[model samples]
Target: MTSLLSVTDLSRSPDLEEVSFTVERGEVVCVVGPPGNGGATLMECLAGTGEPDAGHIELLGVTVGPGDRRPPGLGAALRGEALPARMKVAEAMRLLSRLYGTRGLPGRLVDLLDLEPLLPKRFGRLTDGQRRRVMIGLALVGNPELVLLDDPTAGLGEGSRRRIEQAVDEVRAAYGGVCVVLDDLAQAERLADRVVLLRAGRVLAEGTPTRLIKLLGSTYVMGVPPHLRVDGLRDVRVLRGAAATYLYGSRPALEAAIQDLSPMSGDRVWSIRTPTLRDAYLTLSAVPEPAALEA
Candidate 1:
């Protein structure tokens, strides 16, 4: 089946490079990576707000080139997009609904996003989280075939983030359209059907959450002091961070390594846990660039 959205060989100098991905209907594809990884630029290109230097985007079966207007069935809730400060939330939603030709108010979206209380308030009076919820609601006004949400939950409190996640789930259940969410690794793990990991303006990895976590090739992660050494241990991959040195390996290897350090003071601390998407991301990001490895 044809994808709802296809981005092929998309590039923008200094921000993106040959990035390609597809989003099938009823799927949520979260794009995530470290800071300066070009996610913002990619979202702009997908939303048709910024022209890519090369390649193309196909949205809902229409091929869109650089400088072209965004396709009719595409909706975006991009970060920093502004609404008129004087406009009430309900008024904004109704206006967008009319503009998109959707019948009546987006009542389902308002309830799904828990916006009833804020509906009477002006855009400028809402807090960051409330404003984000409103933006998402506005984006879904027309039930567009493809939805682009850039960092929708950025800087939100836990409660607000959960509400957004729930709202996203409700939107998917109601519309079944493809969603492309630009977020961090944690949110990607919770919200994405598949994740695309980017770094230095290039695709690093892409897969379901479990599949991406498995890329670390370890069942457990043991964290110890950065100065501690586990170099001689078999099957252990060491990732030294500023705060802790993570040792990624199987259960037996970690157990043996811990035993070897049993004589250390009780105050010496260590921790062991299963590998997560964040761990896989860190491991992949730590890899030497292809050119450096080849050299």
Candidate 2:
């Protein structure tokens, strides 16, 4: 399997400390981490919009770092991309089509993004979701071999979100392009073939979503009363909420703890389930602030 993009020991000053990953062709790799932890920087580095302070970045057989121009055959749509306010959707698409040597929508991007009705709409007048759908179409205009998306569906309504998700699946399957996405755990689970967990700009864990989730072993979540002091459970991952004390651990261990506690009240209401990518993510990332941990 040939790697479409590779980053070796990538580092940037404040946000990105040291990061590395490989994106293979036809793979949707999701990059997840604590907010403000440099996931955006990583995308920029790959897209050549920004350069890393140190380390190597290679895409499509081309090397890019500080001062190097972005290579062709790659497309990216980062957050807050500002399109010309007055430009109509058709006009913008036409211009991009010319630039990419495509006379119209590249492949099925027009239909995939449901952009037909939006063609006459002004960019400024479009809602955030509409703008994102346009941006997604724009990214595909060049028929790129790799697409770098920074939360493509973030802040959108459910309808637009589902559309983008469907478009992504279709694009990857039809075009065999690689995608590197920066998004939340749920989206990562839905879209990623491989997941990278980052904290403080460093790679904490990287593997298939299932593989990472399995690292924690058969996890069972038990709910206890908030007033119950659970500081004694040294071997479990606990998330305390206002109404319930959520305990995450192996089924047998949680059962043992429950037996030891001998639930007196509502603590009897508990549920056990397998750990998800979100669970593994929370466990690996940990809570950012001390307040989140203090019960």
> What would the per-residue lDDT of candidate 1 be over residues 175-287, giving only the tens digit for each residue?
55545546578778878888888888888888888988877878999888776666677778889999988898889988877877656535565577898889988888898
lDDT of 2 by residue, 156-273 (tens): 8888988888877865786555555565787888788888887778887888988887766655767778988787775677777677777888788887777666755544645666
Top TM-score prediction, candidate number: 1
Superposed Cα deviation of residue 11, candidate 1 (Å): 0.5
Winning model by lDDT: 1
Stretches of model 2 off by over 4 angstroms after superposition:
223-227, 231-246, 252-268, 286-295
TM-score of predicted structure 2: 0.87
TM-score of every model? 0.92, 0.87
RMSD of each: 3.2, 4.9
Looking at model 2, which ten-residue stretch has the lowest summed lDDT? Answer: 286-295
